[model samples]
Target: MNHASLDDFLKHGTATLAKGPVALIFVEDAVELDSTLRHHLQCGFKAVVALMPPAFELADDLEDTVHRVAFDCSHPQAVFDAVNRVIEAAPGVWLYYGYNAEYLFFPFCETRSIGEMLAFHTEERRDAMLTYVIDLYADDLENCPSAVSLERAHLDRAGYYALARPDPGNHNHPKERQLDFFGGLRWRFEEHIPAPSRRIDRIALFRAKPGLRLRSDHTFSDEEYNTYACPWHHNLTAAICSFRTAKALKANPGSTFDIDTFRWRKSVPFEWHSRQLLDLGLMEPGQWF
Candidate 1:
């Protein structure tokens, strides 16, 4: 069902937010919106919320399945606003958020439902799951100017690294169990990408509670929610295979002309399986066997 505005959705669409494991997909543009929604839906999310501009159209199947909200995605802090508002409305729900052309993949996701993974996480007392935004782009930008193509998607097999996330309030000491992850196209083409947006690590899958806020850096207001793992052991992590960065770099006139191709020797075809990400060490299964 389509709502005129975000407030309208919150007021009238409360039923959609009643359940846990809901996906909040913010549509930045029309590209691959349907595929992104379908992916999450197939992952067995109880509900999928599509926040997009009113001008965009949705497939008939999706129109009936997803809760559509007319939102200004271009506005600054739009993601933060929409997410936090939903968090306030749906406390105790598992919430996941991402942009168009982004796909979430957890360990054993091919056979296991996202709900199953989250269940295991909850059993371990983890309230959030760390996800790396792995950059995906078409092998050739000349034909596919937007740098997106599901059939020909390519991602860097290496170059992923993490640094200690400093705590400014505590004399710049590294935040325990937290690291600022960086890599993919953002790291390869740093000059065109802003420093703040470079980190690919995001606590994308989280349980909402009162006063929970999604920070601009993709971390959370609650410090524990931002941690990569429990102090006891490593926790399950996911990967968001995304073409958003590639699309942006190629779309932006400033960087478009400068980038001839996103492919390099390290670039490899994305197999679209959780095992590939696992083998590459992009994500971990933790103790979930």
Candidate 2:
């Protein structure tokens, strides 16, 4: 469809999406939704929702722009109906990721447009989607040897950037020691998210290789035998570049980084992006709606 048609289609869905680009969060129990909502808003996510509303008006207040859908499998047909209800109202793209996320600390490229993301290839999908979730612990903090591989930055040409919040057990009960973040399983996302019309590329701060290594402790290591970001960790940047390179090359070439990957000894750090938050005064607390 043409640009005008796309714009008209999106206008119809504004009710559900509100001022999105949004994040579709799925939570179970004991997690307070209020803190989660505040964090998402602070992180720049447009809206947050519960996958299974806890049978309370507080969670499913749709007029407020957040949402909750019950997981009553007894009513199987209703699931499809609700999916349609949300889809019909949500415009642009839906990022089915969590507010407490790991990828946020890394480089990210937001999908430029929904139509472009739909067309990415399978090999490109992982590179474009998943995150190499890290489990950081208190004692391990002092031992933080850099996680690097291939010397080349992993690229994802079909993914969007989102945060992965850690649970108490994920880090440490007090949550003061370390954290456990998730990279949503690949197939889990086939439906919840939408495709983009054009790709966007955001480079990653982590250096990576096409392969992984397992440490003596049975943990994952990179080509260099150290902790590393999986190819997918690069997020939208890899997704976009891979897609464009594939179109030009005329076929999907597995994960497009290298037959012979290149690297820079002096790598850039991901924390640099935080300056934007500092500059805009977004780092401070403000009014919440």
Candidate 3:
């Protein structure tokens, strides 16, 4: 990393206890964000939340540092503008993030330069695994859009959770702040949030497919989504398991079928995929380390 980058990280981070904010972008419901904020805070995330088309639930968060900015849902640009507004307004008070975003920091390592990095510590091995993840998404220039984006980011691999594409996309590049050599990278660059780096059992893009224009009803966890004020939409992804069961029934209609009884790849080892994680063992904090 360059001096400027290190300076920015220290200036923007430090007290926040990590690097980068986890951003949760939702149109109406804020329940999941509420759960996630609590989860990360427990896991040591000093998070900042940004929401649009405001809801009262945001006000209920236990963290005093969480912030909210409201915008019209019809205009997605306004929502993003709200994010920029907060980050721009508070240059570096704390690591700023929206609803579900959290920070990832490399506090374990003290190597200051690339030369020092070559003497690989166990931490370096972990960073390499995360880099390989980026590479997996990048290798196929076509057919693999996520990989392509990571390749373009070219984040400093000598760190934990190197920055990837920002949430939504790289649409907002406020013209005023332009570092000549850095402009392109800054365009849609995301601040890297720390993760296990190598221990990510699963990489899920929940409800992220474009064409699956599911209604509020067809959308996963709608019942919980509707009663979010009362908090009925538990962390349980109520849709996925049922969907899997339904698919099985469609393929084999004659078998004695009960959604409750149906299970697929159930006995697999340490499964993190939705289908398998339904009964996967719980992970205590810092288990991967």
Best by lDDT: 1
Q: Which stretches of candidate 2 lie over 4 Å from their true place?
A: 1-14, 55-65, 72-94, 99-130, 136-289
Tens digits of per-residue lDDT for model 2, 150-257? 122232212223333234455623322112221211112223222321212121111222333222221223222211223333222221111112121112244222
Q: lDDT order of candidates, best first?
A: 1, 2, 3
Which residue pairs show backbone clashes in model 1? none
| CA lDDT of every candidate | 0.94, 0.30, 0.26
Strongest candidate by TM-score: 1
RMSD of each: 0.7, 20.3, 20.0
Clashes of each: 0, 27, 10
Report RMSD for candidate 1.
0.7
Q: Candidate 3 on 13-71: residue-level lDDT in tens?
A: 33432323333333333323454445334433334343444443543544365434443
Q: How far is candidate 3 from the true structure (C-alpha RMSD, Å)?
A: 20.0
TM-score of each: 0.99, 0.30, 0.28
In model 1, what is the error at residue 1, expressed in angstroms? 1.2
Model 3, residue pairs in steric clash: 21-102, 22-101, 22-102, 23-101, 24-100, 50-98, 104-194, 137-147, 138-147, 224-233
